[model samples]
Target: MRLHFHPLSPYSRKAMVAVRLRGDAVELQEVDPFSRGLRTAEFVALSPYGKMPVLETSEGPICESTSIIEYLEEQGPAVMLPPGRQRLARHWDRLADLYLMAPMAELFWRRDTPLGLKAPAVCRKTWGLLAQQLADRDFVCGDAFSLGDLSAAIASDYLVRLGLEPPAPVAAWLQRCLAVPAMAWTVELAEGHVQRFLKPLSAEFLADS
Candidate 1:
């Protein structure tokens, strides 16, 4: 399997975390289809939407992080997510897409958009909502780590980058997730990508450290 991902993208991070936690060894390729002159036309053909986190599998190319994760879960072992609660798990994953990832994407994209002036307010609001939704949950779905955990953790890194730490429950949840060896490894890889994108953001994340 080949994964084409942008290092700074939480969506890509989601797929990476799922693959790594499942103990699968796949080739990782960094691509910047968004950068003005970064990617080739051939690569763009693979991702007509010009987005990162495209996974090439034995069957075909799967776009979208959630789809990639589902494919991995269907084929791989270690069962990062639980079975029998398919409906609930799907809803949680949708929540991650709508609530978690959408807000972060807004903040990240606006930094270079016309709404850049309102980025700070948007970021603060995003963090506040996240703190509320994550009030007392160890993971998005439950105590056992799932794809929801990976999505939330990667998205939360943006909160820390913006100099906003989640409230008690969320903070404790994050701490516990990081204490897991697989999660820690994923976080380290993610932090490096974040640092490369925004140097001060990385420093700000470690301010309270």
Candidate 2:
């Protein structure tokens, strides 16, 4: 399997973490979607959306982080998502939907815009939502690490890096997740992937924009 992704993208990070945790064997290929370097005519034939973190699995191409994670868990030796409380899965999904995807979308767009141009009130609101969501939980879903925890961690890692720390419970949770052998392995790999690949690419894009 060949996984196409951008190292810095939280979505791509989720898929990578899932694959690593599940012990799935696949090749990671860095793809620049915005640069139009990927999604050549051939690539588009595989995934019409032309999104990053596309998994070219033995069965077929799986796009989107959640889908790729499900695929890995289904095919691999270990499972990242636990099976119980279907409502909890929904809860985890909602947390990711609310905290990770929404706020990060704002950050991504605001990358080119100056802080002055960006809405301070909106930024505060978003961060507040994140902190509030994190107030009670060890993981996004529960005690054990799940896909929710992995995705939220990667997304929240961005804010933490930017100096917005999670509330007490969430901070402890983040530390717990980080300390896991599976997550630690991914983070070790991710640190180099981000330093050597992602940060430079993001800096170049922001500079040019």
Best by lDDT, which number? Answer: 1
The digit string of per-residue lDDT tens for model 2 on 41-97 reads: 867766678766789977888887888887776665446667764356556655665
As for model 2, its CA RMSD to the true structure in angstroms is: 5.4
TM-score of model number 2:
0.73
The digit string of per-residue lDDT tens for model 1 on 1-209 reads: 99887667778878777777787777999875456423567666666676778888889789888888888888856366677655556665766576656666655554445454344455456546556656666665566777656666666667556555566666777777678777677667767666666533344333423
lDDT for every model?
A: 0.67, 0.64
* Best by the TM-score measure: 1
Query: Where does candidate 1 stray beyond 4 Å?
Result: 32-39, 76-78, 111-137, 199-209
Quote the lDDT for 77 in model 1.
66
Q: What is the C-alpha RMSD of each candidate to the true structure, in Å?
A: 4.7, 5.4
The CA root-mean-square deviation of candidate 1, after full C-alpha superposition on the true structure, stands at 4.7
Model 1 score (lDDT): 0.67
Error of 1 at 114 (Å): 8.2
lDDT measured at residue 120 in model 2 versus the true structure, 0 to 100 = 31
